[model samples]
Target: MDRLFRSRRSTVYSTKGIVSSTQPLANAAGTKILEKGGNAVDACIAVAAALAVTEPASTGIGGDCFALYYSAKEKKVFGLNGTGRSASKMSIDWLKKNHPQHIMPNLRFKSESVFKVTVPGAVAGWCDALGKWGSGKVTLADCLQPSIELSENGFPLSQCSADIWQGEVERLLQMNEKDENLKLFLPSEDWSAPKTGDVIINKPFAETLKKIAKGGKDGFYSGEIARSIVKELNKRGHPMTTQDFSNHTSTFVEPICYSFLDHKLWEIPPNGSGIVALLTLGLIDSLNRNGTIELKSMKHNSVEYLHLIIECLKISFRDSDQAVSDYEYFKKKFEADFHSDAEQLLSSKKYFDSRSSLFHPDHAITNKEMKEGVPNDMFKSDTVYFTATDSEGNACSFINSVYHGFGSCIIVPEHGFALHNRGGNFNLNPKSNNCLEGNKRPYHTIIPGMITTESTTNPAADEEELYATYGIMGGYNQPQAHVQVYLNMILFGMDPQEALDASRISLFAHPEHKKLSDRGEGSDGPSSNDITCVGVEDDLDPDVVEGH
Candidate 1:
């Protein structure tokens, strides 16, 4: 009986290498790459490629990408900020004049956010990163093969994917559901009851892959693919200019690394909410003078610790609310040169009431009056993430997304792609960042972190010497998740997989993201209180479903 019920699958054991991702296809992609002698960076790209095909709802070629790669040879870590920029042709005043909300204040969005739209930057990003870091054995096609096989032939329909699919059925089927793209991806007569194990295929996606592989990344940006996306946007009244894709470029930037509890943390700058994460850790470090914040202990989990950290969160986030913006704004606005002031602020205990508001940053700017300029790097999209490690001591934590999954679902008929709805991150009825300003990077929700510390010989000694490369994926949840999980790993000492398997709850889900996918709700049904953490403010109940 045990043999009969036992699953017939190979075990994924690895003391030498490990790959973890939201989708199994992505995991396999990385696994294959590692087996072929590809480095950590190469394995990361392979996984990303697989994710683009299998988790289309959460990620794709049209999304933004951020990664932290540790180089074994150089003994250094590099960061990649593959976020897309706003159309260079756009302007803040133009957005004020065009005030998208004026046209569709209550947009009947069938997708994540109509305002969530942004330029697609992932394909170029993937290509660029892989080019710089790939090994001889690695190739785009190698990473994509399994996904292509699954898409063109078939793979099991994940229970989660099926339930999520059904939830979006009405909206997805709005355009006759007969569209070849939709049909090629979903179950049909042959897949009536998509239970735990059912074959689902996406041949169109496979065709898309072929085009991408043959033409290189540019094919997706300039050829038939580009047209499809542009046409779809033009038809929907979006202003994504042809010149937009023509001018698109993804950059490689220095990764931001911070030292904490004998370990270093890493993140991307400005455009990502990563700075906020750093701020939170910095603030906590300031508060925890004893350098010990624990959990699972009755005293540590008490209201006192939670309360102190909550206050710390408020101060740290205020810094995020004020200074974290596009590169132009960060340079022009929060000109204090953070590092110089960070230590002083920590020593003086000077975070609250000394506050940083929009007004504060404005005053801090050297050229206070010369504000009318271009926004070259405002983050504008949703995101996804993954992590991988090679025995060679190289590790990578990556987060990428199409702003919102399928990004606006505003399909470009010609290219068969959708744009991001990142414009939605801005505020209304007030002067705000992340607005529908042209060229502004949107407020991003993906932060990939690496915890590096020397492995200590004394497990019974102090709280030092545990190295880990980990990441969390929900938008606003990204930063908070980073902080919380970092604590969970250090203070609570949970293993990486166990930490990920655990629930991630935010007092508030990012400003607009829904509580995961409806399918994220378990079939076992609602937990007692869909909500958790009384002091926080998400509308979900304590037990219905866990979020992250």
Candidate 2:
């Protein structure tokens, strides 16, 4: 077979079950659950809870989660939106009156700010998914035991996790000296971040996990844990109440899809940014169908191919920013104004054609031109993504995250976890679809992806067999990576391992369009005129880089 990228690792074939994650401990925990006769959903929950303990820098119970589960028995995919909502008191008017500094253009709410904390929904998501799809063999308590043990007995930190933890030391120290995080995370006399291979014990977190294990969702949502989160936020001048925590619930929605290469790519609907992946794939499909760009004919990672993909991604980002938002908000607004819903309008062939027409085959579109083309609108986001498939053929594509590194930089001392800063993604512009509102979810970034064989007779039918469950963790790199990895396997005939190992590109929003102050500004970086800045991995050929 012709191949542009060589695999560094072979794909493991499993007959019983498979669990893949960034940390060995987390993966082991999931595998243990599967070995005990748990289904994919149970294994995924086991992995997620274990990741919260083992990789605290990227994810925890204080964050949010999203998942796509393929139930082999039913032959259908289900989506779970575990994202949290902004505080009931949060609003543009409230921010203008209470914290005007956050409303300034190009100024982002600090990661450590109390206003950035959202109602964490991972625990609720885990409970809901378990109730809906978990194997009867494993109880919630059973699924959480591995993490509880790891947290209480202490687990050696992996090198990559150690690096991420160390990077956040300063940010942690910048919090109040009396803060409990100093005592828990920085156990050293010098208050330093733990080094690689150091055994770290999180007794407090273990206790918190115990609450969830015993009481299930209520264990975390209504008891001491809820009170602690509310007390901390209230003490910090935020208007979070225990009721807000109690009111939190996960939503089960239909997974959206885009047909390409005789298969269907599935993702969680709005609120999560999975729509961006579908939109990006739709544009490329349009280009391929119309003979504008023959993706299969181009050399993998060639300058021409990279440029086309980058340009297509820019368009997708622009459109998603305007279109993607909390499902209820998006549905209401679009239904009233456009007489259409997000899934139908955004995924329609007409929308793809209109967006794809702006793609120039030879040159990049200017930032101004991109802004003009879209009707609307619109993070090294630290996240963990892993996939599991059980012997029963059930598969779960799961993702969990804190919006940024050490989310909100505010640790709940009693709980031993940081509160996620998901509210940081909300727009201050009231007219925007993603504008902050009381008890409203922000436009979430972390998304889990699944793909299945398409029904040739009816491409849009929900009746399809599971092909794979996969995801890549990062901020905006997710959707771009999703499209790239999917195409690598489907269009280029690369194996699963090679599809993942292959070189890829990432696209960032134009600096001028971003509300965040840090856009990596430099003389050689993205300029005001550029539509979107493209970053290529070093593994790609230098000649391809120069040609672009």
Best by TM-score: 2
Model 1 lDDT at residue 471: 79
Count the clashes in each prediction.
35, 0
Best by lDDT: 2
Sequence-dependent TM-score of model 1: 0.76
- Candidate 1 lDDT tens digits, 424-506: 55433124444435566765667788876643554353223327778777666677778777776676666665555444445
| lDDT for 217 (candidate 2) | 89
Q: Mark the regions of model 1 whose C-alpha exceeds 4 Å error after superposition.
A: 1-15, 92-115, 173-178, 185-196, 290-300, 328-383, 414-417, 428-430, 454-466, 501-505, 509-548
Tens-digit per-residue lDDT, 307-353, candidate 2 = 88888877767666565677665444444432135556555777678
